[model samples]
Target: MSALSESRNPGATRSLQVVATAGHVDHGKSALILRLTGMDPDRLAEEKRRGLTIDLGFAWTALPSGQEIGFVDVPGHERFVRNMLAGVGPVRLVLFVVAADEGWKPQSEEHLQIVDVLGAHGAVVALTKRDLVDEPAIQARTLEVRGRLEDTRLAGSAIVACSASTGEGMEQLIGALDHMVGNAPRPDSTGRPRLFVDRVFTIKGAGTVVTGTLTGGPIAVGQEAEVLPPGHRARIRGLQTHKRSLEVAQPVSRVAVNLTGLPTSELERGDVLGLPGQWRGTSVFEAWVRPVRGLDHPLTHRGAYKLYAGSAERDARIRFHGASELRTGERAFARITVSRPVVLDLGDSFVLREAGRQQTVAGGEVLDTDPPARPGPDPAARLRARIGLDRATLACRTVIDRGAIRTPEIAVLAGVTPEEVAAHGAVRLEGWLVAPDVLQGAAGELSAALRAYHSKHPLRPGFEVSEARVLLGQHHRVLSDPGLAEAVLGSLAASGAIVREGAVVRLPEHRASTTGREDADRLVAAVEGGEPTPPTVRELVAAGFGPELIRAVCADGRLVRISQEIVIGPTMLARAEHLVRAHGAPPGLTVSGFREALGTSRKYALPILEFFDASGLTRRQGDVRLLRAR
Candidate 1:
């Protein structure tokens, strides 16, 4: 069937990406790949003459079942380990190539460690150059390699002896790869299309073009896409997979796209192309990094490094939390702050190299693409929080449990296809959805806290909204969903769970008792009879009342603290009434004038004036205060 026909047919299964071949220099990796795919992957003349791949190469083969399998031929040289890492990020299967004559090499082991770190779904070992080794020698070497792989994730993977020159085991290698591909999971086609740009250049007539194995979703000609980090939008003018022009390309297929509108200067090999606004450049992320086993030095904080992910490379600073130094081969949670924003999703694989030395130090999976700003205290706490959310479903639930999880954040944390998470629930394209239970639980906690607070400070008018946020801590912003919090507060008030007095929140019982008490009565009497002066806290306390009770009365609006020694209750009402009648309107009163009017000193007058400012009884300007409208 035509590629397009196979993509559309219900019975035709999606293809798989099988990344194979490893070992230091001249292992016949390229030759074996050429024999399998019948396509020369080594296009560079330097690679042809040197008989080794210096960069990543791609080739494809159609299996007996009509399923297409793409292979990523990565350089085995120690210097190009970064290139190997870049190619492994999007692959599901590994074709580990070991030369029978050369046995195992350093780069081969390093490459295998990288494949394990990347979490390849499956693997097949090719013992190439079998013609150079006798049958017994080949068998012994293959067994030794198998023993070495026993403790690894690729332990039980199929191993086949082959010679690219004689093509002895070519059919067997194809069969093994095909079998693994059939079992590999299919990529989700739903969501945003993201192609990690592995190769970028201008075709003779196609303008700026980029090629990479389609890692997620599908892209079609004429579809609009955006280049990330730099964030330039463009349209797909052409599409090709496996060197054949096609209308559309699906996941696991090697695709080259000719783009329009984006200048060649604006595009780069690492820049990811995706549906506009589907992905974002991330500055902060949480990762569970493992240092390469058997290294002498420990991973240190603020250590500069080069980070590689899906054909993208950038400089970054690593902050190792929970410990000052990460021992060689030790695993720890780390926060990576990139020098600039890069398009990254949750579960994406990344390699870290020592900044200037360019040696692979560590590699890890992304846990969070955009983590909340965390400063001070134990950095390990943030790491643990991320570690607990390693599972996709649990992570998704945690986001829901926390109230709102951004779609992009969910995609980054779960490592599942972005489209799958986006389809799991109907969330606002920009805002996340909070589960009803989470919202209800937060509201309940808020109400209980307010009630407890009112019980402790009966004289206080209510709880301020800002104070409530401080008390809630991490749940603060999650609950501060504008009218949502207010609605909960209102519900509590209506149910007598709490009382709302302006901006203050109080217990219903406390508001009633404080306002009806005799201290309130005595305060009113003292203020009205004492030459229009307000009663102070001390003066009110002397009248068989506590300072707390006096403050409560003032907060209830039955009395006002006009001065330190002079508290007014219904007394300001009379003065306000008199002033309005005599002057047509109340005049602006200075601290001196307010003191004279209340017959108190400046010390007593200042706080009372400010109290009026808080109550909206007067507006302060410079040193003067004006009576406010009722």
Candidate 2:
């Protein structure tokens, strides 16, 4: 079996490596890959006819050291720069090609700028067509290329002079690639796999298939995945890497997935496939951007710009921090608003191109994908503090900023796992991770609302829970979510900061106080003297006993308010229950029968029975009452 096929076995140990090519048009990028792998990098019919690369092409080969690596050959024409970025934007290791006779050209400079912005993990620069140049000419061209690499991330990358036609220096070029691939760092796997689809096509019998670089984690066959932007779900029917069938595709390698659920009509290039809920899409985000070196004009908010990241390209509008415009070399914080929602994460690099001018202008690292609606004063400073923070610290700060957030939501909002979020030591209540100060503030606000409620309705036992929800909703936006709102109130109760009773909530110190007031005693006396048939609330109000005092007496257990109009003494309530038990048998007790037993009219007896029914003390059957078993 071939080396690429061997890696697909379960016991294979060597991880696959990927390399993307960068250079000017017809500078032997495709030619070098064809010479190295014995497979043509230019796959399109027009590309072979015109002797030019029009789009991205793929080829793979085993290195001299038995390491399997793949090459993404990209077009070097300025018009196809979008396709070139799609190839190189996600891969970290680069194989830069420059013709020895022609030296550095315009597209050469532009491609280098893109590689520098994306920040390669390792690179090998190939100076092709060495047979066309003299030894002195080759040395001079080497020095010219070295000048451009002085401060770039690819500064120390080896530059090999070779000829794809004659195979000059081919062995040295192979050795450099082997060394670069050997030392490159492994891709971090967080169990959240993301595949940015660069090419989408339907197979005759395999259905829809998409090819892209897999990162963040491994994707196994039969696992469910979601296609983002529209978020249609599908199952992975099969997996392939370098045209070899595999049960699972590893990260930092090229992968093609055959999906079962969604059709090719629904998916397109730039769409993402991942585990459901692993990625969140946002149109607005904050970033730290710096212009590319040697721009002829200053970078301003005005211009038709396109933002490129992974395989996705979006129309974007940018606003700078603390300034109206930025010079060629100045760096500043910026807020980018895309034309539509796209999946972005922290520290992901993107390139900005001025479409009107048809040139790449700037590149930036994403600082925050979910920025605040109104960026307050010195928002730049706030973002700067977060620039170098670890994931845990950033998750804690995000929780603090949101005051109270759903625990699982951190994974969706910031890509921080639940365990990482828990390690920060934030307070979690009812699945909500809350900031310490915000929790304290929420308790205080609830207490204040209860106090106001008690003062306004001193006769009431406590604040009604329904009203409390509405009142708290006005104070804290978190209260608008029913689950989160109940969580806050429950946490306060758990901490003994408040008390909850059935449908009401109250401060711990609250009480229905009519103590030592003359109206309280008078109301009780009037209710007791009236016996089974007590005076109506209208009569009590007419006698100068306010409705508030009557309600206070009722709340104090001195009186039972049977209805809006009827108020009875506690003695009367007990007497009615006794009569119901005595007469409640066989046919059950009727309102008139209880009325005569209590020596009251039907008007008072009807409401008395209803109050008993509401309290679960009795069950009503049509017009008769049945005694309930305690």
Candidate 3:
């Protein structure tokens, strides 16, 4: 037998298929499994004593073609329907059992509806108790089962009559199952592993153990994992499949994970186990739903509904789009909000059951995990655009929907890896993924803001950096966050949309101009005439000279800025520097002596000396100033 081995590691198995069993109570599903695998699937003592399958049992067998198949034996009693849904939710194939004498029963129809909703990949019907019926009765039961399955995902399934008690036709049933397993398509491995825990128990020295069908990818022993809802970290101490210890467990197979750092009381059934930061729980999502074929009334928002997905079930409320209720056989997009958060992704299938009546109501396919808080009119248009898209495209679309998003946020919202999101063609600004249209719109708004800034303060060099950030935040809400706003500015600067200086931002073509302007000439003349102690900024603003014009003349070198409130002509600044150099060498120039040399008062001299000190032209020690060495 050829073991399904990973190419990277020659001795390691890469693939294992799991098939779940479904049928009516006491229909010989468990007995048939024992006959085929020679191992009893019923484990609980109460179940064995009652002679009815309860909870979930698991077994495995190797096929003739070296393919290993694991079986999840689900209870068929009406009372244990929740257990059955949990077993079959993540699985894609089934071995449907039906008693030949009873034909189709109540639980059989309900289970079949679930299988159809889940879109089972392939199936084989085991018509059990064949020894109790004649050849004619066997033919009639086969026809009835086939007719019922004609409209389901298991329509083309092969039905083989068998009796687990008498071991009649067991060989033929095994061959039929082997053929079905050999041709089944492989499960998707998206590099994000999620195991919806179905059972949590603790062994003496091993600590907590959780069992479920692992999907999405492979999980290795000793890997770091996380349990959701409580959202705590746990390490995988060991892994097993069908009682055989494995270094790594592949997707779409039954797995028992021994986890450390979490108690059994904290981790329960319906919780999720996954790699840290790879999964996010959401309480509300949007999906496309269809009611069952024979619903007695219209499916409305006012019902006690429970949603089943993967292995988790939560109380849910449904609100249809463009309508208040959904009629039978009709499909519509709807928003489903659950009482508790669940980890779901796009294209995931879920079953909705009316809890009061204990009957299945509708089934749905998830379209969006993180939907808008208020869906505007005709929201279905947005969902329709998302149909049939791959993960990368969907991640890119998420960026478009939100205007700009970080890579980590894209991974969480779109259910893809960071690497996958990075590989897309969208514009990447720093750590944020930006859609092309959004980037273009931001560029246009920034350009317009810069133009307006230049027009309002014509003499200034540029708009202030702090003010530019405010404008960007106002235009794009996504950039309101700390680092994201800077990323947008950087991208704009790099693309020549604007130029960013130390304290200001401006259009590339903008420059501070004092040429042929009456107001600029007047401001420069006023600062030049004020000599050593010029009119302060407050005085200039009070004297009908705009502060922007005062700063502009200073920025253009027509006037020198000695302090926030003090400005002087370039000639005055040069004179002050020379007077300080001549004030001479060592124990430094005292403030009083320099004030006398510059022919200025103490207030003007102090600010000039401090400005020189700040500009690296001089160093101050106590009240003395020393000229810096050239």
- Ranked by TM-score, top first: 3, 2, 1
Q: Residue 17 in candidate 1 has what lDDT?
A: 62
lDDT of 1 by residue, 1-630 (tens): 112223332233244465656666678788888898888878789988977788888888888978877778888888787777667766768888889998888877787777776677888899999989899999899898998787677999899999999989888988998888888776655356778888877766568888886766777777898888888999988777775666767776777788888878988777888887677888888788988766678778857898877777888988876777787657888889888788877677788888777677778888767665753376556455655443445455445545565555555444454344444442332345444455556556766776776655565556786665554444556556554455545655676766677777665665645544555576667766764444456765776677777676666777765655666656555564354234323456677766676565676567666765776767776666766767
Where model 3 places Cα greater than 4 Å from the true spot, the runs are 1-11, 514-630
Show pairs that collide, candidate 2.
none
List ranges where model 1 is wrong by over 4 Å.
Answer: 1-14, 188-190, 375-382, 385-554, 557-630
lDDT against the true structure, per candidate, is 0.71, 0.85, 0.85
Error of 3 at 454 (Å): 2.5
For residue 174, give model 1's deviation from the true position in Å.
1.5
For 1-630, candidate 2 gives per-residue lDDT tens digits of 122223455533235888999999989999999999999989899999999999999999999999899899999999999999988888889999999989999999899888888878999999999999999999999999999887788897899999999999999999999999999987877678888888888876678889998888888877999988779999998788878878888887888888897899998777888999888788999989888888888888887799988888899999998988887778999999999788877778899999787798889888888887778788898788878877777777777666678888888777777677768866777888877777687788888877876775666678677777776677766667777778777888888999998998988887766563567888888878887667789988999888677776776677878999998887788899889878777589998889998999988999999998998878989888998877
